[model samples]
Target: MTPRDLLRSAGRNTFRRPLRAFLTIVAIAIGAFTFTVTSGLGTGINTYIDSQTRAVGASRTVQVTGTSVMSFLNERMEVYRDDMDTARGMDVGSGILGEEDLQRITSALGPDDEYSANRQVSALYYSHDGGQRYRFVYNGYWPGKTANLVAGDQLRDDTDQAQLIVPSYATRPLGFASAQDAVGRTVEIGVLGQDGEVRTVPGTVVGVQEKSLIGGNLPFGNQVLDDALQDASWAGSAEDDAQWYSSVLVTGEDPDRISRDVAAQGYATATAEQTVGDYKSIVNGILLLLNLLAGVAIVAAMFGIVNTLMMSIQERTRQIGMFRALGMGRRRVFSSVALEAALLGVIGSVVAVALGVLAGRLLGPMALDLAGLDLPGLELFAFDATSLVAIVLGVTVAALVAALPPALRAARMDPMDALRENR
Candidate 1:
C-alpha cells in the first residue's frame, strides 16, 4: 500500500473502538496541556525579569558592597566575646567602603569606566506647599545608570544642586495632579537632626520614577543632595565620624573581569545579568517540579494507549489474517498501527495547545490581580512557537512508543494461525 493509503486505513481503524480511542486521546491531552501551560508561565516570568534587569541599568553596571567579616558570625552567644570586642573596636570606615577604598577602586579602573558611590541618608521628611509633611526612606540615585523614569529627567551627578526624583505613586500624595505636573516644581525635604530638630532643604523635582518591584517605596537623589541630608543629620552630634558609603556602582565594558577584580578588593559584587539569571534559575526550578507532576498524567495516558491498542488487535485478529493473506507485508501492518497511534496524539496535542494558550492568556492576569501585585509593564503569560512545536512532538512520540508492542504482535502473526484461531 502507498503511504497515503496506509494513513487513511490507520485513521479509520483507530476509531473502530470509538470509546476507547476517545479516552486514550483525552489522557494524552491532559499531559500536553500541563506542559504547554507550565512552559508559558516560565517564559512570562523570565521575560519580566529581563525587562526589570534592563530598567535598573544592570546590563553595563555592577553593585559593589564592602565585605564585612562580622556578618559571617551569628547573632547568638556562639559569637565569641573577643569577636564582639573586635567588631566594636572597628571604626565605621573599617567595616564599610570608605574614601580610601573608593579612591583605590577608581584608580584601578580605565578611563572608560565610571563609578558612583551610594551614601546613606536617614529620616527624610517631604511636603508640598510647606504643609502636611510625610516621612519617607531614601536611596542614592546613580547618574552613571539610566533611571526608569515616568516623568521629567534623571538627576545630574556633576551638580551639587539640590535635586530629587520622586516616586510615581508619591506624586498624587505630594499634591500633584500627575507625575508630569510634579516635575520642575520645588518640594521641601527635611532631615531630622540628632538634636530633635528638622532641617528643611528645598530641592527641585527633576524627575518621577515609575513604581518597581524593587526599590519602589524609596525616593532617589543624586550624590550632592544625599550628602547635604547626611551632613545635616550629623551636625551637632558626637557621631561626626568619617563618611562611609553604603555601596558603590561601577560600569565597565567587561563585567566578568570587573566582578572578579571587585571581589579581589574585599568587596562583593552583583551584576544585573547575574541577578536576573539567579531569578530565572529559581523560576525554572519551580516550573520543573510542576511539569514533573504533569508527567505523571502523561505516563498514565501511555498505559491507556497500550491497553486500547491491545484490545483492538484482539478484536481484529481475523481481519489482520485476511490482510496478511493478501499482499500486505508485516512492516506495512506495523506502520499502519503506528500511524494510528500518531494520529491520536496529533488530535490530542491540537486540543491541548489551544486550551493551554487560552488558559495562560486569561488566567495569568487574573492571578496577578488576585495577588494584588501592581507591577507596571508585567505580562504574566508569554507563548513561543518553539515551545508549542516541542509539546506536540513530545506527546506524539510517547503515544507511538506505547503502541509498539501491540503492533509487533499483530505484524508477526501467521495468517493461517490467526484465521484458524479466530474461527
Candidate 2:
C-alpha cells in the first residue's frame, strides 16, 4: 500500500475500540494540562520579577555599602560590651557610606560611570481634603530610574524643588480620582525628627507609578526632595558632625566588573541582575518540581498507549497476516501502527492545550485574589508559545515511542501463520 493509504488506515484504526481510545486520550490530556498550567505560572512570576528588578535599577547598577569591622568576629557576643554601648549612641548612618567612601567609589568609576547616594527618610505622611491621614516609610534617591509611570513625568535631576512620586495604589487612598489627578497637587509630608517630633514638609506631586513587586510599600523621591527631608529630619540633632549615606548607587557600562571592584574596596555590593537571577533560579526550581509531577502523569499515560497498541496487535493478528499476504512490507506495517499512536497523541495534546489555556485564563485572577495579592499588571498565568509547542511535540514523541514494541511484533508476524489464526 502507498504511504497515504497506510496513513488513512492507521487513522481509522485508532478508534477501532472507541472506549479504550477515549480513555487513553484522557490520560494523556491530564498530563498536558498540568504541564501547561504550571509552566505558564512560572513564566508569569518570572516576568513580573524581571520588570520589578529593572524598575529598581538592578540590571545596570550596583548598590554599594561600607563594610563593617564586625566581620572579624565569629559571633556577635565576641564584640566588647563597650563597643556595643558606643554603637547605641552612634548615628543611624554610622558604618554606612560617608563623604570619603563616596569619593572613593566615584573615583573608581570609568569615564562613563554615574553614581548617586540614597538616604533614609524618617517617615512620610499624607492627607487630602482634611481627611484621615496615613503614614509610611519612604526612601530618597536620584530620579531617572525607569518606572511604570501612570501619570505626569518622572522626577528630573534639574528640578530644584522638592517633589514626590506616589504609587498608583495610593491614588484613591490619598483622595485622588486617578493618577492624573494626583499630579501637580501639593501634599504635606511629615518628616519625623530624632526627638520623636513630627515636622510637616511641603512637596509637590510630580508623578505616580504603579506599585512595584520588589519595592513594596516604600515610596520614592528625587535627590532634591531626599536632601531636603534629610536636612529637616536632622534639625535639632547633631547635624554637623558628618553626613552618612544609606547606600551608593553606581551605574556603568560593565555592572559585573564594577560590582567586583566595589567589593574589593571593603564595600558590600548588590547588583540588580544578581538579585533577579536568584529569583529566577528559585522560580525555576519550583516549576521543575511541578513539571516532574506532571511528567509522572504523562508517563502513566505512555503505559496506557503501550497496552492499547499491544492489545490491538493481538486482536489484529489475522489482519496483519492478510496485509503481509497482500505484499505489504514490514516497515510499512510498523509505520502504520506508529502513526496510529501519533494521531491519538496529537488529538489529546490539542484538546489539552485548549482546555489548559482556558483554565489558565479563568483561574489566574482567582488565584491571585485568593492569595490576597493585588499586584497591578501581573497575570498569574501567562502562556509562552515555545513552551506550548515543546509540550505538544514531546507528548506526541512519547506516544510514538511507546508503540514501538507492538509495531515490531506486528511487523515480524509470518503471513501464513497469522492468516490461519481465528478472527
Candidate 3:
C-alpha cells in the first residue's frame, strides 16, 4: 500500500475500538498535562527572574553578614533567625562584630568598591494623617539599590531628608488617592524601642514602586531614614559601645572576587547573583521532581498503549494475512501499527497542550488576585511555543516506541499461520 493509504488505514484502525483508544489516550494525557503545567511554571519563574530582577544579581554587589554564635531560642524562633545565621555549636559568645572585624571587612574590598552597613529595624507600625496603624516592612538603601518606580525617583544616597519609597499596594491603605499622590506624603512610623517605650520616626515618601514576581514588596528607605529608625530601635539603651551591624552591602566592579576576599576575613558573603541562583536552583529542583512523576505516568500510559495495540493485532490476525497475501511488505505492516500508536500520541498531547495553555491564561490571574496582593506583571504559568512543540514530539516518539513489540509480532507472522489463527 502507498504511505498515504497506509496512514489512512492506521488512522481508521486506531479508533476501531473507541473506548480502548480513548482510555489509552486519557492515560497519556494525564502524564502530558502534568508535564506541561510544571514546565510552564518553571518557564514563567525563570523568565521573571531573568527579565525583571536579573539586575539584583548582575549589578556587582555582595551582601556580607556576620554569623551569630549564641541564641537561647527555645521560644523566640523569629528573634533568633531575623538577621543572622544562628546555627552554630556552643562557643563563648563568638562575640559581637568588633571594630577590627569591621575594619577587615571594609579593607578587603578594592579601592573602587563602596561599603554601606545595614541598620536592622525591628517590627514597625506606621500611620498616615492620624489614621489607623498598619504594619511596616522596609529595607535600607545602598548605592547599588534599585527600585522600579511608578512615580518619582529611587532613594538617592546624596539625600539626608529620610526618603521612603512605597509599593503601589501601600498607596490606598496608607490613605493616598493614587501612586502619584502617595509620593511626597509624610509617613509616621511607631516602633517599640529596646527600652520598652514607643519611638516615632517620620519619613517622606519620595517614590511609589512597582510590584514584581521576584522582588520583595518591602518598601525602600534611604540611609537618613534608616539612621532615624535605628535610633528609635536603640532608644534609652546604654551608649557604652558602638552599634553592632550584622550585615553590610558592598558594591564594586567585581562582587565575586570581593566575596572571596571578605570570606577570608572570617565573614560570609553572597553576591546578588549567587542568592538569585540559589532561589532558582530550589525552583528548578522542585519542578524536576514533578517532571519525574509525570514521566512515570507517561511510562505507565505507554504500557497502556502497548496493551491496546496488542489486542488490536490479536483481533485482526486474519486481516494481516490477507494484506500480506496481497503483496504488502513487512515494513509497511510495522509502519501501519506504529503510525496508529503515533496517532494516539498526537491526539493525547494536543489535548494536553491546549488545556495547559488555557489554564495558564484563565487561572493564572485569578490565582494572583486570590493571593491578596497585586502582582501586576507576573506570569505564573507562561507557556512557550517551543516547549509545547517539544512536548508533542516527545510524546509521539514515546508512543512509537511503545508500538515496537506489537508491530514486530504482526510483521513477523507467516501468512498461513495468520490466516489459520482464526481456526
Predicted structure with the largest TM-score when compared to the true one: 1
Sequence-dependent TM-score of model 1: 0.84
Model 3, 1-423: lDDT tens per residue? 778898899989999999999999999998888889988989987877666564353367787766432222311222342323321211123233445567999989899988877545654688788887888655445555676788887777687798888877888998999989988889898866767788888889999878775554677677788888877876765665355664677988888899899989977677767767766898899999999998999999999999999999988888888888788889999999999999999999999989888888888788878986466567788988899999999989999999999999989866885668868
Write down the TM-score of every candidate.
Answer: 0.84, 0.83, 0.81
Off by over 4 Å in 1: 67-95, 99-111, 158-160, 192-198, 215-217, 233-243
**Which stretch of 10 consecutive residues in model 1 shows the poorest summed lDDT?**
82-91
What do the candidate models score in CA lDDT, each in turn?
A: 0.77, 0.77, 0.78
Q: Give Cα distance to truth, residue 218, candidate 1, Å.
A: 3.4
Native-referenced Cα lDDT, model 1 = 0.77
Please, what are the lDDT tens digits per residue for candidate 2 over residues 1-423?
777898889988888999999999999999988988888898889889877875665377777766432233322222233323312222233245567778888877788888877644565576666666788666457335656787888777687888778888887888888989999987777877656677877778888888767653455777777777876676655535455566788878788989888778767677877766766787899999999999999999999999999999888888888889888889988999999889888898878988998999998999889988888878888899999988899999989998899999888987985757854
Instruction: Kindly report which residue stretches of model 3 are placed more than 4 angstroms away from their true locations once superposed.
Output: 49-58, 68-96, 119-124, 129-135, 190-200, 211-214, 228-243, 264-266, 370-373
Clash counts for the predictions, in order = 0, 1, 1
